[model samples]
Target chain A: MISFFKKDFLVHWRDRKEIIISLISPLVIIAVIGIALPGWVENPTKTLQIKVALVNADDEQAAMQEFRDSLAARSLPDDELLDIEQQLEQLSPIRMLKQVFQAEHVKEIVSMEELGNDDALQQLQEERIAAVVTIPDGFTLAALNKMVWNDGEGTALRIIAEKASLQVGVLNDIIDGYVQKLNVQSAFHHLLGADAGAAAIASDDYSGIGGREMVDGVETVTSFQYYALAISIVFALLLSVTMASKAITEKRERTFQRILLTGSQPFHYLMGKMSAAFCLSILQLSIIILISHFALNIFPGRSLLFWLGVSAVLVLLSLCVGALVVLFTALVFRLHDETANGIAFIFSLIAGTIGGSFVPIYILPDWLRSAGEWTPNGLSLAVLLQWIQTETVADLSVPLVKLAVFAIATIGLASWCFPRRGRI
Target chain B: MLEAMELRKVFKGRTAVDDVSLFLDQGESVGLLGPNGAGKSTTISMISSLLTPNSGDVRLNGVSIVSKPQFIRQVLGVVPQEIALYEELSAYENLKFFGSIYRLKGKQLEAKIQELLEMVGLRDRQKELIKTYSGGMKRRINIAAALLHDPQIVIMDEPTVGIDPQSRNHILETVRLLNREKGTTVLYTSHYMEEVEQLCSRVYIMDHGRIIASGTTEELRRILSGEDTLLLKLDKPNKDLANVLRSLAPIRHVEETDNGLKLIIAKHSSLLSQIVQTAESHQVEIINIHVHTPSLEDVFLHLTGRTLRD
Candidate 1:
């Protein structure tokens, strides 16, 4: 084993062409995305209300006052209330609100001449406005039945809103939702009953199932911690494929056979290349781990076990991948001429993606994830995540055993595929 | 000493190496001469234990290498046709890796590396990447790599296939010198007739997975002595003249050559009289005639009726 490891160490330390395959890409990816774009909170919540800039074009005061009174009556949470207050002080669109809150949604009012050539809607969204509500000019009588709390006034208030933007459509949703809520409150108070406050008090005792936490009745994972973990794992898989491809290329070039001629056993040759792969993988995962903590600031080493568990899986995954790669490399070397490297590359990539290296299982459709879980790549990723999250080795009992099974099974398969040839 | 007893290897549906056997005594040099796909490499691979013969035994110094390949592996060094040194490492580094495998290490390994580098005439450029070296240099280092362990027998498989003539000569001379001075037993394989004729004490000519002939170079050539050779060149070619010449007494052989025809006759005999009469009758002009002894190529041609590669 010392002899084998020495061989591996010499090859890796001396060979730059093969070294880059195992090192550069993963580090660069970590540096560019994980480090450069640090603090990417993957699962952002809409619970914190955003403030928007509003501009009103109303010529009347009575309708504006009534709209303001209706909007103020909304029993919003403290954050949303503060956001709304800040936005109104900035936009003052309520001074231009056309009706009392009867309609489900209200449009924003703006003089085209006053609005510059800038992206006003984008400005609203970025400034935390839910949406821009623009109301057209009209007499209060024209909307007596359509309006929520319309007491006939001088002229219709034209409200100019700046809230919802296109990407994620979050800000616009908040503004539209608040508009509807205030409209209903206005209707109850102005149209049917004078006991709108009492009605709200009675109906406020409303709670429902956790829709956001459970997406479509499945346990939803909102944290990007899982996504980062998944990407790094795939990167690790790609690293294995690269290492495997080199092994195949070397064999084809007769380097491995030449080593054998030097009194090196088949196992020594196999384990040497694998040890090189395993070491490089450990280095790669270390860099990725450091990226998550120092750069992304996500998934900090929760405890010693979390780190240890990740390291252990990485080692196992590297070995499994190395075994699989060598088997393919050996198979290609024994069978094909000049095309072995290409075959290994295509095979490793196929295996990597099948193992969920590119797209995470959670992001993939349910059918894809279910079918993909059996593949070595997918199982490796799942096993890793389970191992990382669990507190003890006992909790990882099944996954560790399954990983061992995968390693042994792949080695067996590779052994079958790479049957010794060119000799009697 | 290296020995192969009835070595044979069969591939998918073909017998790549058929019942073949040869032996090399300590300090003695031998050659395997054959065409492409003629089982020379297969034989070498078996002897080197890179391959396991289907039914045979290779013994290094009387130890059964078939059951225990490690013995042959340890006692043998191989110079494969392809330049198998790692392109990524310097020539020194490549040799270091190979040397360490044979249990050479530290100061001893470094000293051997330096000594071998000087032996191959590349001591100054040892640190350069193997990839950057020219073909001849790589071949020299390839040979140097084999010498790293100083094994009892060194097997070379067409080691100078594509090197320059100067490098080829230099490598052959180095092999000859090593064998002469150090008594390094060598099993040199090549299709190049002249190389084996110059360097080997005995030659084995293989064809269609079988050794057609194996003996001392001169001894092998002596088989064709029964048929004396004759050469004839004519101004006007006549097909009938050759048959007429063959009927003459004291003449043993007649064959075509590039310039004209050749005739082989028995020792202390002359057939020019009958040949001149026959050629004159056939209206053929005789140009020149001469007799020469056989060569390794001739021995191969006499046995297999073709050159090594053909």
Candidate 2:
């Protein structure tokens, strides 16, 4: 295994053109994109504001009264009825929705105004608003029933938009976040009982909806830092493809067959390719980070702890990238076609695009951003950014575990796909 | 000894090697002779355990290596038809890598690499990448890479193809040394009859996925012992003369050569005089005439109606 690793490393090192290209391409892209689009990176939300019309069709008083009457009809005890009524007043879904939009950070991005349904539609068509948030009639009654009693189908918040745009996407994300929080609140209520569930919702962590925490008093990421990290991750992912392409050459030249004939285990050969990719990825990431920091001050005035955090993320990301290399290598050997390289390249491109390596996850729709977080590169990028802001070590645990799992799963799949004795 | 029994291989429903059987005794230098698509590489692959036959078994000594490929792999060194060494790596690096995989390490591996470099006459250029070397130089390094482990059996598939005469000679001498001095069993495959004749004690001739004939050089030559080849060099080509010669009762086959006509006839036939007279009657001048004993080339032509190269 060590011999295979050394050979693969030497082979990659000796290819001067490929090595130079791999090291320089990311820096060039970072420079171009970072310089050309400063606004998108430096202040992503500075010039962007989502205008929304909040049309409240439900009467809070009438819904509370209707809820009380329904409880009376069910013949609940007086103490239980009072307890249910108090919980309803405290956890009104409409009030929660309004509070989310009213948050300071949420207010900075979304400007909401109360308007009638006809007026809201007219303004929306006239491009006066990005979307219209409608609170339907009986929403509070239905939501209270579902949350407190686990009865009846829950009412959904209706969002009407003129078209799908960045502003509309952000607005939809904000609403989606609120709904998810509500569902969690409801689950806690059922699992932990009413008082514990209410206490959980009243906790400081859940106080602000769509609000940003100023960790360690650090400012938000600049365009240069964002692109430097994003492009670095994208190129790091590309290293897997590069390694697999080299494997193709070995296969074509019959060098791989020669190695096999030496009685070397196939697993060792795959691990060798993977180790080379892992080393290359770390090298590429380190070089890019150091150069960008020294030359461009991408991570200006960062502490030792910050650098250590970056290193940890780099190692985990490299492991995932290495595992990806073996998967691509296995596919290259199994398919035995020219398109194997193309397939790997396409996969990297798609992963980079969706994983927020090409674009910031904040700008993506809620669903897409969630998916991007699941991707190795995307997860790493998010964690690294968080590390930059918070300088906190505790946050790395979940993402690191996820990255390790990704590595293990990919390596397992690669082993399954790799050709065995007779197949080779 | 290494033996392949009734080996057969098919790719995408097309038979590649069909019921081929051959064996190599310990310390013997045997040749597998065939044309480009005669299944030589496939047969070599199966024997080396790099490829499994559809329905056949290869054995090392008395064990069936088909079910236990490692048995053969341990003792086998395969020099593939293609240059399998890493082009980006130097000759020394390639040798070191291959040697290390076989569990050779430390000073022993370094010395083995040095010895191989000297044997292939590339010691001075060991630091240069294989991509910078000439075709012959690359082929020499390729051969050196296979010998690093000092396996008991070496299977070479057209090792001398597309190489300079000097490198070809060097490779052949290396094989001879391994077989004669080192007592390594060899299975060398090539379409060049002379190389086989010079290096191998026995040869197996294959065509269309099957061995057409196999025997010692002298024994294969005896297939046409009753026949002799007649060469008539004329000033120019004359199809009419060839036809006229073919019609003769003594001549069995007549073929037109570039500068003359060749005839196969009974041994010790007195047809030279009659052939010269016939050329004279046709008003074509006979440049030269010679009677030659049959060779392996003639034997292949006699059996397959085509030259060995074809």
Candidate 3:
């Protein structure tokens, strides 16, 4: 058995170019994916800078002068005069709206460009601006009347954006929070009247629900980790295909017969082949993962135990690769050499595709994603990604068990199809 | 002695080996001779325990080895028709791997590989990959690999199939020495009649998955003793003259050749004089004429009605 293992290892080692080439595909995949997916893999807390046209048609000074004139005409008593002054001080709706766009989080995410309503719509249609927020010419009187006296229709902040873009979603959520806070302030004003209502508005916190809290000071997995795992599984499948071809080449070269003549049992020979494949695959995965970790920083903030858990899952994946190679070679050898090679290549390609090695699983249709998860490498990628997010052995149990079952089934079929001596 | 009794094998409803049997004594160099697809390889495979017979048994030292293939394999060295080697690895590495399989290691395995390499005339090129070697060199290494374990019986199946004359002669000589000097039991299978005629004391002539005849060369040739082969070497081609000679009553078979005509005649016939007179009348210059006894080729023709390479 040792001799068989040593022979396989030496033969593969002599053709080191193939090994290097195999390692290259996965790296290229990970690099291309990391570069292609820009914002998705980044820290969720990172803000987006959207250029929005702010069409403010409100004439705030004119509205304030009109309100003071109306109050002077009343010639109110001393207490009534004090109450009116306080109400006037609290009635800066234009200032409040401006502050909404200037808040710390909102300011980082959106930059306001003041423009006429017609020009804002033109910029929006041309796609030069991400969105348009039009504050109508209602000025402050409408807001003050609607809030304190409930005498007129409330002013609306008209927002225009493309339905498909992330900018639309961000702007909509932010505006929704503002509307909610304003309603809370309105309710307090109705209950306590104008003088004490100003205090209620001060305490209203409009931070959106999607805020990121630093958990254990550890960052979540980046986009690099997703593609790194994806590419690793893909190349591992390719490696299995090569291994099957290698077995066929050996059979053609007649080296398999020589080994059989040396009194080596069929089981011993297969075990040696599986062992060599497993070792090489594990080694390949380890190199790829470590390079991605240290160079590309795939799973930043992962602990030692996290990596160890990853290694354990990778070991299972590598064993599955080994068994898959055996099964593919055995099954293909039942046909002519050329036909067998074609089938093996097609099978590998299908497995890679369904395994989400080329495209991210989340982008796939729901049914396809579910179907892909049942595939060998697909399950492996899913379990691994989950483990990266929450490093726990329990998360790997289903995939690990499924991989074991798959390995057993493939190995058994391989044994059944494997040609014994004198048959070929 | 290694013995195969009533061995039979079927592949896809075709009888590849049909009730064939043969034996090799402890120190005898036996040859299994047949044309291509004549079941010689199949027989060798069964006898060497690399293949199992469907309805027969093989015994090593009077005990059935069908259930104990490891025992038979341990005592058998097989050189298949194909090179059966790792072309990417060095010749030395190939030998080391095979030696390890037979449980030989360290200095002992290394020394055996060196000795075999010297025997096969490849000692200097041990470090080179087998792929870099010529066809003849590969054949030599192939033989060396089989002999690594120094098995009690060496079964070689067409070992000299596509090599140069020098390597071919080298391999025949090497097998001869192994059998003569080391007293290794050998089962050499081939379609080359001269190789078997030169190396093996006993020969088994197989045809269509059955051994048609098995005996010493002299013993097998005696089957054709009643007829004599008349060899005539002429200066040039004489088709009309050869046709006239074929018309004679005493001639059993006449084969026209580039130089002359070969005729099979009765053991003591006056056809020789008639043939000479006819050749002179046809103006065909006779370079040489000789009457010889039958050989293994004739024996094969006598048994199978075709040449060994048919």
For candidate 3, list the clashing residue pairs, or say none: none
Q: lDDT by residue for model 1 over A207-237, one digit each (tens)?
A: 2201123234323232345545556666666
Q: Over the stretch B1-310, how does candidate 2's per-residue lDDT look in tens digits?
A: 8888999999999898999999999999999988899899999988988888999899899899888888988888999989998888888888888999999989999999999899889999999999999999999999898988888999999999999999999999999999999999999999888899999999999999999999999999999998999888899888888889889888888878788987889887888789889888889999887888787778888888887777
DockQ of 3: 0.40
Candidates ranked by lDDT = 2, 3, 1
Q: TM-score, chain B only, every model?
A: 0.85, 0.95, 0.94
TM-score of 1: 0.64
The candidates' DockQ values read 0.29, 0.57, 0.40
True interface contacts reproduced, per candidate: 0.53, 0.86, 0.74
The sequence of per-residue lDDT tens digits that candidate 2 reaches over residues A304-349 is 9889888999999999999999999999888865777888888898
Model 1 error, position B48 (Å): 2.8
Steric clashes per prediction: 34, 0, 0
